[model samples]
Target: MRLPDKTTKMEQAVAAIPDGAAVMLGGFGVPGTPFLLIQELVRQGKRDLTVIKNDANETGMGVDHLLVAGCVSRLITTHLGLNANAIKQMNDATIAVEFCAQGILAERIRAGGAGLRGILTDIGMDTELGAGKPRVTLDGQAWMVETALRADVALLHAAAADTFGNLRYAATARNFNPLMAMAADTVIVEAEQIVAPGALAPDDIHTPGPFVDHVVHIPELTQEYAVVRR
Candidate 1:
């Protein structure tokens, strides 16, 4: 079958995600987050979600929205320092949090996208993060094996996207979006601007259309983060 046109409404996009599904969210903080899609998910009251992200965003924003909605059952991420809610929830045993070293987290997702079993690293070896996990020695060097990370759905934010679903992300916002797009079963991108195919140059495209399953056009944000166009 031919590839389908991926443009979709935000509501319909988030509605397709079921409870208890593993979800990968692309963003370092608020910069590249799919805020509208995340809002819709919270509004829809999705439950038992396993969220995989780089960090738990600040309280009352981003990933914190999901946490506040009590929708997330588990979080696999590198940091949660800025989000006090995540820390409290973890302390309360309300949410399960798995901490991975930053570099290891990225490598794990990259490995998943490349169809590798996992990535081996010595970064956290002998530390709490590596405790109880399997280990292997390569060339006489001890390395902790971090399993590849994959998700049922990935939510991403792009600065611009073509109708065909090709995406481009702004600086800083580009962090995890590209890798997560490749690692998920389905990827839904929220774009500030959507253009016709070929509007985006090949060199400018960060994510090719084939990896994306859906796209929703949002407005652009100014330097101050105010919505400049709606």
Candidate 2:
């Protein structure tokens, strides 16, 4: 059987996302954030988005764009220390923000991808994060049952990809790309470069083609792709 090419236009991929959808954005600040995808999402004016990300990236970038556009309704993330816009919006009741412990958040998404129901941990049992959460006692200790997280769509940035949609992320940029790729109903990638199927060896592929729905090739990296910090 011949493998079909999944390459597509960024606009079409992003436009498929409807209003009031849950979206998982892959990135650690600027490195792996799909800037073009986010821009398109903003341009298309998608609203009431519940964004699941590691952090609310600083103002003028990433999720901040969605926040500024009033596209986000709730933010599921680890922190908002860097993004004053997110903080302001959350504090002012413009958007609801749910905080999760770093490792626990990753585990929750991993569980979703694996088709598990949820995870139990003592990580935040005594904190506000654990408040009102379902708890179970295993052995002799109590643990919070954190539900798995799945998204309607996942936007990822890849260092490179093949026409088949096999993706490889660069260094730290790989942070949530691989995980989010598996946990979403539709996974769209903005690749710096898209090559022939065989161009990316199987060993180097971080996200296999079958898990990705669309691969959008970016002609050139913009100013947002530049390293803001090392």
Candidate 3:
């Protein structure tokens, strides 16, 4: 018995995402984001997408590219402070933006991966984000029901990956990559470095290969990420 190799071309992987799909992107700002995959997705011109991520990314990068290309219809995220374009789009009603508290967003995705329907919380119960959302009472206190978030496809970036698709992230880049991998129906990963199956030690593997669908190797990051890659 042998483990399957999930390595694939970047173009082919992004091509599988259909228009109007719910997609999860693994990243917190520039790190851990699949820039190449996002670039390919933009080139493919898939539209009407519902994107879930931690941030809107800055102008001319990551999620902003999708916004500029008019690819995304709705963005489920934490904040749009970093990207003026994202704020403008939200204000102009060009894109519908759903804001989630950072911790709540993570828990929602974790709940999805854990196969739970949703979780009850009081984090946003008194805020606008919790407004109009369903609620329940527990121990004489009200808790808002925040549903889990699962995606049709997940785009991830890893520092290194083995042939079997085991992945490892560097530093802060690990954010959201592992969780998103589990919550998505199809998980596609872009690795800066590719190694043999056993090259990555068990302890170093952040996201196991079984949860991953496709792995693409990119030898070098684009120059725009020169400072970021540092």
Candidate 4:
């Protein structure tokens, strides 16, 4: 059976997000970040949010705008080195930051999507990253139990999407989008191009329509380089 078209306006796409919400932002830098939706979120003045992402984006772009708007209270990400503003906020206790290993972060989200409690790994064992986490021993080997990561809403950007919400990503833009889509209760996508269902080949679909709740079509395509100019 075909799914209903989930296309919506930017405001409606972010309306479901409440203050203090845990939001998974799909992007490896700006490639897959939903900038338009993020802009609307900033305009809405929602605060005290917990944002989950691969990295804190560079200043004045993408996720950095959230930091600038002071909307994010906590950040769960691989690193903040790319975003000087985030680093300053973390240091000043303006925002709390949790640094997870990149691979572990990905696996945790994947575990959440797969309905697993968590996965045990030795990646951060005996290190600051695993300092307080519980560890279990199996076959004389110890591993830290990393809980699965889930979110209330996931913000995503797609290269193209069908009316039914099936998504296609461009190049590295596919990085965290598909995983977050599955792990979040609400998945909202900002699509560069919107087409009819079946326009995208089955094999080309990166995220299925069933996992997506809403899609916002962007009339103009905007690209931002991931590089940080210091």
RMSD each, Å: 3.2, 1.2, 1.6, 1.7
The residue pairs that clash in candidate 3, if any, are: none
lDDT for model 3: 0.91
Which runs in model 2 stand beyond 4 Å of their true positions? none
TM-score of each: 0.93, 0.97, 0.96, 0.95
Itemize residue pairs with steric clashes in candidate 1.
none
lDDT of 4 by residue, 23-110 (tens): 9998887788888888889999989999999998787887899999899999999977878999999999999999999989999999
lDDT per residue for candidate 1 within 58-97, as digits (tens), equals 8767799899999999999999999899999999999999
Candidate 1: where is the Cα deviation over 4 Å? 1-4, 220-230
lDDT of 1: 0.88
Cα deviation of 54 in candidate 2 (Å)?
Answer: 0.8
> Which lDDT tens digits does candidate 3 get at residues 1-230?
76788899999989999999999999998889898898999999999999999998888789988999999999999987988999999999999999999999999998998899899999978889999989999999889999999999999999999978999999998889899999999999999999988889998789889999999999989854555432
Ranking by TM-score: 2, 3, 4, 1
Best by lDDT: 2
The deviation in Å at residue 197 for candidate 2 is 1.0
Task: Provide the overall lDDT of each model, using Cα atoms, as 2-decimal numbers.
Answer: 0.88, 0.92, 0.91, 0.89
User: lDDT (0-100) at residue 229 of candidate 4?
Assistant: 46
Worst 10 residues of 1 by lDDT: 221-230
Q: Compose the digit string of candidate 2's lDDT tens values, residues 113-213.
A: 88998999989889898999998988998888999999999999999999998999998999988999989999999999999988999898888999899
The segments of candidate 3 whose C-alpha lies over 4 angstroms from its true place after superposition are: 228-230
